[model samples]
Target: MQPPAQVPPVPPPEEEPQELARFREEWKAELQRRRAATAATQASSSPPQPASSSESTLPASPPAKVFVPVSVSQPRAGPSKNVLPETHPALNGTERPTYVSPGLGNALSIYRQAVYAEQRSDLDEALLLYRQAFRLDPHVDRAYHREEMLASILQGQTAAVKKLTVSAATDEEVEQLASNLQNTLALSKPVSTGKAVVTGTLASLISGFPQELAFEPENELESVPIKMLPDELLVLVLKKLDPTSIERFARVNKKLRVLSLDSTIWRNLVSKTYRPPQIPDIEYMIPVIEKHLSDFRRVYIEQPRVRFDGVYIAICHYVRPGLSENSWVNISHLITYHRYLRFLPNGQVLSLLANEEHSPQQVIPLLKPSLRMKGFFLGNWHLEGTTLHLTNLIDASGRFVLQGLEPPSSAPIHSHLHHSSNTTSEDRARYVFVMSLNLRSRPLGRWNRLDMETYESISLETGDATPVALKHDRPFWFSKVRSYGLQV
Candidate 1:
């Protein structure tokens, strides 16, 4: 047999538009059919308008249909205006994208539908409405709140970035705050004269909070660049700062913290008092963290950073928008590892119950380590909140207690402490999953007013409950954090 009818090798066929064009036509036909079916159903669903029999005489006015954004009830902060609308490319050699607003009615109509759905418990519909509202005006008031809630549930803290700085409320709070806003353009008002008086004369205060002056500039005290120092020296400096302060130093500069989230500092945080014989890098922190802490783990580091102490955690979800899922996963793992999770990536010192049974057990892992959930600090937690993540701090006492933080505006302003009652499970629900710390020191030396401006807080029974009770009153959350080998 002639081996086989030798057939010339077939050349690979060139791309063809025929099949592609055929698919396009098919899609178009299907879409048209769907529209036709929709129209037919609408026609059949409504009864014919009585054919205007006998040319009716009475004039009937159409109903007034009011329009509201879907997330109209969510909390909102500051003023927002349309910034970007469409996905237009940057003008210059920049990659930043611009938006093109498609007009109000077009977007507002969609928003109304979403709000309608939310009213009916249609979560998906509510989400769609928020997206539409964003399209109408990225800066829409309640639109931001609605969007944040969706993002928090869907994407967690990593996505709660822009939302945290703006909206933080349930529907009612949104309405009241919007009306209370004194200016549409300003997010915050000037420091009240009373506040200034209080903060200015804090030393004489009774010692309410651990410290109201959070590392203010002290003469030559200055923050230095991480790049300027040697890695060894850098490591040395980081060693001295307690884990809390080291985390704060990381956020002081995006580039700085981004570069510092390595094993050196994280490792030292997990260990048993690993102290560096010598220290370098005069200003800022980093070195202090390495020297004070021990052990390191990969799970504790990420772009949406978190730094912590035994009682508190600083959640840093300020990463730019449009992050990949993998990066976000690592960001979230810290929450699971630490266990006491804060929904938003905002950070705060958890008050450590040093004597609590569930307190942390020191483990040797990274040879440098900690974000101890249950531990002792100054005493017990009182209240905490913030507009942005407060990851920056200084815990000089080393009991994993927070030593540096500005007093809350109300702290010094109010001369007396306010009390809140939590008698049942419902009352305690708010504190269940939050990151916080309480400080305790026997009635050391009592003073009526510390430096005249700052007033001291006494006991919890006598402390002010207003700060912790009105959750919506403040634009912050008690952030949870994990560190080094503490990956749960």
Candidate 2:
């Protein structure tokens, strides 16, 4: 069979109304009339010729009229004749044309175009526009952000907009308003007023949730079980949990956060951690809590307390001259050592200094006082503000000796050398060491750093106190020890 021939489609039966055709003709004639009138006005505005005998004899000629063609198919809202169209150079005479919107001559507008293009997934166009924007103004991003923020603020404040009427503001005026608003906001920061402010992504997300514990039923007909628990009972249950556990529980929901931030829990933990039987009252010892907005959570975070569930370690290094087989070049060795400090809740602290031969993993587990390791020292710590005072420091290893010191004599002439004639070797060896350290939170919330400020050794036999130098000491960083368990 032969292939079927193609059929021509019929056009619509609708015809142009006579009135519409007449309107179109009138519009065309009006455009022509306006164009002719414009040309006549230009001719009249031309400069007159100079009057001369030879020039006056010749008749004056009319000025030539220029009529530029206007495309009827183009949109009427396009750029005016005086505005130049934006164009980009072609690559290999094969690249497609990219049309940019008109009136985007400045950096801010170009940056906005770039952002719009990026949102539409036009990566190539966005990159090109971004380069153009930065080339024109380096701070276009900041200007754009400022304008956007001001626009949002104005849009939100209907009453203020009506009162101040900034709709007619120029670009410079808008910028000035934004700057003034920023300064005013900075100056009007909220005072503490004893109110605790919860900040962070999680806090903001849960802000609108109910403060009371909320439980959803598994079925529409079933009742929730946790909704019956009273706040007092819940608080008591939270009290039994450790600080870390309570924090983890609080992260479950907003209700738990409010319960975790209860003044009783944090206040009790703070008192138990800081106040001992020896120091019945710690008001003078710790910083004033009111300054921290009287918030127990803030006080717990900002207060400097020696942690017992971890070891504070300081690693030190120094260059030492090494013995060389050859007599030509002197060799220097870098010596490494670590100092460990473990504090107890009863005000006792264990300190030990070990060489690099014994790594932290090998030495930290053997840091107990019962082991009596070499260089192990037992001391008592007292806290006053950020400063920590360690006194009555004595050798626990029982191997330390004070060299180059003369023994006690029965004669009264050399009594200054020793406290008494009956001073034993053990008494002479038991030199009382005193160390002062400044405590600081490295990242401003965790109390995990200690800096050595002063060290002194007091002779029990001679009653002479000598200052010990800390030339090679480093700041101690806290490392949690699982064996020590939770502090509270």
Candidate 3:
């Protein structure tokens, strides 16, 4: 019976071989899938490698293990499973990696370039690039980047940090950047050379409180009221000022305006500054003075004619044609003569004349003798309206001769002398001048002095003899002199 049972030996179970074949096919399929996946990943992630000369002939080595996270129930040598949830959570079926669009990646690249340009101080290019990046990706991060740029500008940092990254930037990071920028700006500001000093008094004054007042009993000091000051006091203060200052004060208020415009103030000013030569009847000149009050201020204060003292010296130039250079044709030979006149307050006058050959010093000696004869002229002057009148002209030549001075020689003395005779009454009459006061009341104006011979001849021809109505010559301008003997 045993020999008959052993005859049918057990062939290996057919089911086991079938199961092994199925497992081998599944394993091969998994290996092929992994290889295809690895090749696709390499193609997408890496650039193509250049072929070497011996690469095609060389034998390939076994591929190194790439420790990628994967789940497998196969037995291994290690005790623990190779799980990498943090690195590749998708493999563990925990979490999938987030996908970023290509457009967003491009925008990020542009943002990085913009940051680099800004760091390089290329603001225009950086701004343009930033705008393009924002247009591509309108996200909160882009908005924050824009805000960061604005904060940089506000902090006075046109150049951004070189290593700044948009992905890592946060509100806290931006705030820190701004703080650092502010600190840098503060350091860059111009520092004062003066040392800083803090006093308790100054601190209290700035805070509007006394240092000890807080702890002391309440006792406030009374404040003085400036507006409550009397009008009389104000007027007194204004009266002490000059006309210009008074005018400025009048602009302060209506009350001061009325006070400054008071006629008495201007009248006082006129009397003090312009002592209009002691006239007999001052009442007659009052109306004239009142009418030209503004003119008086301009002539005296604004444009003062006289010096601090009361004297005026006039230098006159008489230009006329001389003997013709060419006898055949009439040609102008221009000649100029200078005449000096010194005026005093008591109606005294001194006269001198100069030529091209001599200065005033050289001419003074040649005319010294004449200085005794016609050296000085005496007259009484008065202002009628705005016209100056010189009357009672007396020849002091003979009177000085009686004082034991020899008579002047009749020979030509000065180069500009028109006569060779002793100083005559006709010559003396030329020193008397009747001047009209200009609106400026300056010493510059038209004047008519008697040319006795011409006046007599014209009177003899016209048969009028009405003091020979004299016409004023050219304008005679005079400068104010501090003293009578002063030379200009």
Candidate 4:
């Protein structure tokens, strides 16, 4: 039986190559299943690491490319996540990698809001939004912001431009913005070449609401053109503007500079806004008034100043003869003091002592000599043609003392004496000042004394007395001490 089974046992398992091949295939399938499970777990648990430079060449499909226009009018929902490392040759050799991230998307949204606000002339809100966008993502394109800034400047949003310039992170950025502005100005053309008639009532002439001359860019891709408004329109606009605004506009261009010098504009402005003190024969002084019209307007509306607002000095000589022989002698003395006279529009005046020395002292030695004490004089004044009439002089010298000096202990002697004296009301002293307009000299002009007065004096030699009047006409030279307002 063994011999008979030997034939079948001999082949017993002549190991089949097919069986070995099957086992190998089964092992490979199990290994692949384990690897796929591990890979799925890793992909769900963590984000994929960025490929190193060595792995850049690995066979992997690239992400879809996204092109964001430099100037986007509307906001996008979100940015992409797949960012490819690539250099943009067009963006000034910058690495304009796909900036698709949550932070960057929020930044773009904020930036879009800022652009809309700026377009509507809501500069404050626009600036705030722009700052917020940058804070969220500094990697946003600067050119977009630059374009918005240039647009604002072209629209004459000066306050906004100034604020943006101040907010710049570096001087280089400011310089770049300034350069862009200069380029825009260089390309600017006149707003309207046609001339329009300025016909209307004087009151209605400046009543038109200010029309904003904003620059309308042809498209989102083009630079905004600078606006050059017509001279007639400019004049009308300037008439409605305050002096400060007009002055600021004058610095924009040469055309504005010439337009700002229109005499009629200033004259009309002064006549409409200011009421000069009642002047007699004002028609005769038209030439003089026109010559100084600008200055007068500034003085009336901007700042009112008077001639008696500075220091003055005068020397006087007096002679007295004594009862004895060879007793006649002349005494000379110097008078120095500062007078601050502020003339208000309500016909009232404020006078103050601006000098360092309060007490008056004679420069020349004398005995029993009368001294004119220092005091402040107040009253009302009026303008008669080019002359100033100062009258109703009730001395209100009790206000202030000289700088660095204490106030007086008791009321001045003149206050009581003038009140008690039996002098007629007509005998009260009044001052008449005639102004000389010297256009070439500073301080505008000089105030000359048109009236003279006499004072009682006694000689120290023999106690003899006589009346001495100011002989030399000492016109008090003056300058503007400070500006005056209607209220003060």
lDDT of 2: 0.54
- Badly placed stretches (over 4 Å) of model 3 are 1-269, 272-280, 285-332, 339-341, 347-376, 396-472, 483-488
State in Å the error of residue 232, model 4.
9.2
Across residues 61-96, which tens digit of lDDT does each residue of candidate 2 receive? 222221111000111111223311121122112332
Across 1-488, the per-residue lDDT of candidate 1 in tens digits comes to 55778889999976644644454465456547645875896599667542222333333222222111000011222223323211112211233211112454356557666655555556676787778777776555333233322222223212223333322322233233222221121212222221111111221331343322232333456864434665557556866766556767766543344334444454433232211101111111222322222113221221012222212221121122333568545332111111121221121222221111121232111111122211211111112211112121112112111212212323321111112221221221011112222222113311111111111221111222122232121122232234432221
Q: Is candidate 1 or candidate 4 better by TM-score?
A: 4
Give the candidates in order of TM-score, highest first: 2, 3, 4, 1
Candidate 2 residue runs with Cα over 4 Å from true position = 1-234, 277-294, 326-330, 400-430
Clashes of each: 92, 1, 0, 1
Q: In candidate 4, what are the lDDT values of residues 278-341, reduced to their tens digit?
A: 3332222233332332232332332222332222232222233334444475443333433333
Q: Candidate 4: how many backbone clashes?
A: 1
Of 1 and 3, the candidate ahead on TM-score is 3
The top-ranked prediction according to lDDT is 2
